[model samples]
Target: MAIAEALLAASPQSACTAMIDFSGRVSKNPKLDIRAPGKLSLSHLLGWQGYRMLALLLSDVLALKMAWQIAAHFNQFYSPLPPELNWGSWLRLPSLFWLFAAATLLFFAYGGLYSSATQWKNYLRAGKLVSMVYLLSLVMGYFYDPKLDPPRSLFFTAWFGSVVLVIGFRLLTTLILRQFEQSQSPIPVFLIAPGDRLATLSHLLEQQLNFKGQSASHYQVVGAALATTAHTPTTVQTILASKAKEVLVENLPDTALASALYWQLRRHGITLRLLPSSVDMLHRRGLPEIFAGLPTLRVEPRFLSSLEYGLKRSIDVFGALVGVILLSPLFVAVAIASRLSSPGPIFFRQERMGLHGKVFHMWKFRTMVTEAEALQAQLEACNEIKGGVMFKIRHDPRITRFGRFLRSTSIDELPQLFNVLLGQMSLVGPRPLPLRDVERFDTWHHIRHQVLPGITGLWQVSGRSDIADFGDAVRLDLYYIDNWSLNLDLDILVETCRIVLFGKGAY
Candidate 1:
């Protein structure tokens, strides 16, 4: 088949779908699109990868210069320069040294030393490239200028110094960058394999690395699909919905299946990583290594690194503080309305489970009668949620006329910003469930306790009170935990705003 014909034949998608699901809801707006779907460019240097590259580059430059200085110092010790050539001149690099330094950097770049490739992060590569550059410079210098004869002491010392220093500097850079990588988010990955291999692939992808008594996985499986359904639009939608940066596929039934999925993901700027059945293909496409005693291909995702979790907390504090200040007027209005509509305090304080099952008082504008909790036993029969782990009533008798508007608009939750500022809650995360709700939670349901509870979350934006089953809500919470990212938080916040404005799912 012709090349174009082969590519066209492999792609199974009918057309590119412009719409993307933010949180179980479709968003057609391309502007607020919060996905980093495309490959990296100059702009990427502004992020985590860029910081790494810059560190390596600076290290290389320093290594090269230090090598030159060391070479000069050694030559001076053995064969002192004449009175005419001062110590400064003896230490200064000649034009020839500058030429060789330039060539060394060029060779390093050619060998992918400054790129995002993990294999090139080792000192061995840097040493090899430095040796090659020095050797090539020697051979070319001999040919270009036959009379160019430097002292043997200076020549060999510089050559050896260049290789050793470059390697040493790079190793140092790796140690420093490793500290930052430990705190960064795992690369979000989607798995595609036969049903039998799906679990194995997920386990491997989520394998944790131990560093300084702390363990963290480099990859997080956000979604998975059987290879049989890999080419379907539903699978494609699931991958996109998960906001996966890379899709890893293995043991495809046919080459076309892989090709088609690749094309579909490529269109959305998502990367397709392959684990070929044959050794030759694995070597060509990915880094082959022993994973869990099984030979496997390591296809690293090109992810940006930074102190994103710290940044998230910083944003939470700043946003919560600003929110309280700006919304104080609304707070007073709601307080007055609640006071006049019902005989109760303006703020309702309930004990809610927070991070690691710690109990804290979560504040909310009162949206029910003062006797609401006392009356809950009588309304259990009318509970709308199937599991009853959570108590919910679409239209409860306890809601006063003014409280209904507060509940519908989500104005009742504004007081929780205090919890956020107090460090008990976040601006975005799994919502904190009441102590009554926590008492009935299944073992797995408490996994949401691992992170700080939030004012809004995937559960609140996905279906809110519209969801009938608590299990489905817990599943969404799990998904949020697995696929958590700064962008995902922002997307949830945007979706929350839209939902609140329209009052789509709230009681």
Candidate 2:
């Protein structure tokens, strides 16, 4: 309660002004305010609020139940104790047993176990809590009633059983709530942003926030304050006319404007939030924090940590090794075909820019004529794609007969396994572009090099050559960088298989 109060108090009222560069056209009329989505009574809120209480009650009951069951199992297995030395006997001493159970619950609650706001949060907190409770119970038993406590060998079994029971109860509850939400009530949301920012916010909300019966039904755009360049009113009334339950401001460069916006929204009894900046959006950073007595918002970057990188590398090496072994026959066959069909080396080696702009030799099975690079300039007029980076004809005349089959099957990229094993590439990540392509990239495009390049990535699986827009390509790469996770990588791998089998977007 104290923490929640402190957090609420730390957030201050802010005033905001929305400005538009409308081709320097000045209008005497005020900009119209539009309403989008507002808060709604969500069914999930009921489940979220009551889950902690239910979890605690369930944990206590399950722990006791498991304790008794384990005690019975121990008596059956190691029968130095009589059959009567079970839960029934323990229940006769109800005062002692209940006291221990109460202590366990208290210990769990104190360890920040029952304060979770989400299902994953609950499970993680519960696991920690149950472990703490088990340790406390063991300590208390060792000190107070060693003789009554079960054998040390059974301690782990009892602890394991209790954890399963607690986790099982939470999972079951989550399943029930999910099913109910899927069948019935809609999730409610309020969207607040400037007119220009509303479209992007709406797209995001539709993708992430629209749930079941509730969609973003209301959107409110706060109009600019009526004032000259110098001395604008920084109060809530000057900006917002209608009462907003939540306020979301687009990323404003002026701290004064941002602070003013926050103040005005809060003054109108609204919960203030800021639309993530382009940097934040690209990095996928979560909510900003409100520090005590500070008007400034501090947002933490949500990039993959070093530990995550290490885990990804481990998976890469393991997967690459397996792939190399499993696909060696295909590799041999492609090598023979390339050598027979082309007059050059079986493998085409080219320098490509990798992580941190480092240059490395990338290998691919020869998929074009020996003079394909020389023919690129002549074929420029025939190029179908429009971009600074080079993309040849999909059915380029320079490609060898067998090269077409190799390119379609993605067998041409097999030599990249050597690059993966060399720590120059990953099994999944942004594609490493040639140095020529990297040189042509603008400042924002350099972000793809922040991580090691991959053999198959978001681009390859997300339509590859089919996507003609360079901006979309860069966005996909940025999305992969920002949202990189083991599970996401696995999903990409699965998608890659489907893409390969169908050769959907291959040239």
Provide TM-scores for the models. Answer: 0.49, 0.51
Residue-level lDDT of model 2, residues 1-507, one tens digit each, is 222222224323222242321111221221210011112323223444345446556756775677657755765576454332334455476554466567656655444344322323367666667678778776876687566656555567667776777677767766765655444422222333333444555454444332233433323333222211101232243333433334334444332231223322322334444444422442232334331111223222111123345677788899889989999998888877777776898989999877656678999999888888888878778876667465657779988889888888888888899899998888988888776676667645665665578998988888788887776887787677655666788899999989988888887
Count: clashes, candidate 2 = 19
List where candidate 2 sits over 4 angstroms from the true fold.
1-307
- RMSD (Å) of each candidate, 1 decimal: 18.4, 16.0
Best by lDDT: 1
How well is each residue in 180-247 modelled by candidate 1, as lDDT tens digits?
97777776777777666777666655554423434436667788766655755567888888877677
TM-score of 1: 0.49
TM-score, candidate number 2: 0.51
lDDT of each: 0.70, 0.57
Model 1 alpha-carbon miss at residue 120, Å = 5.3
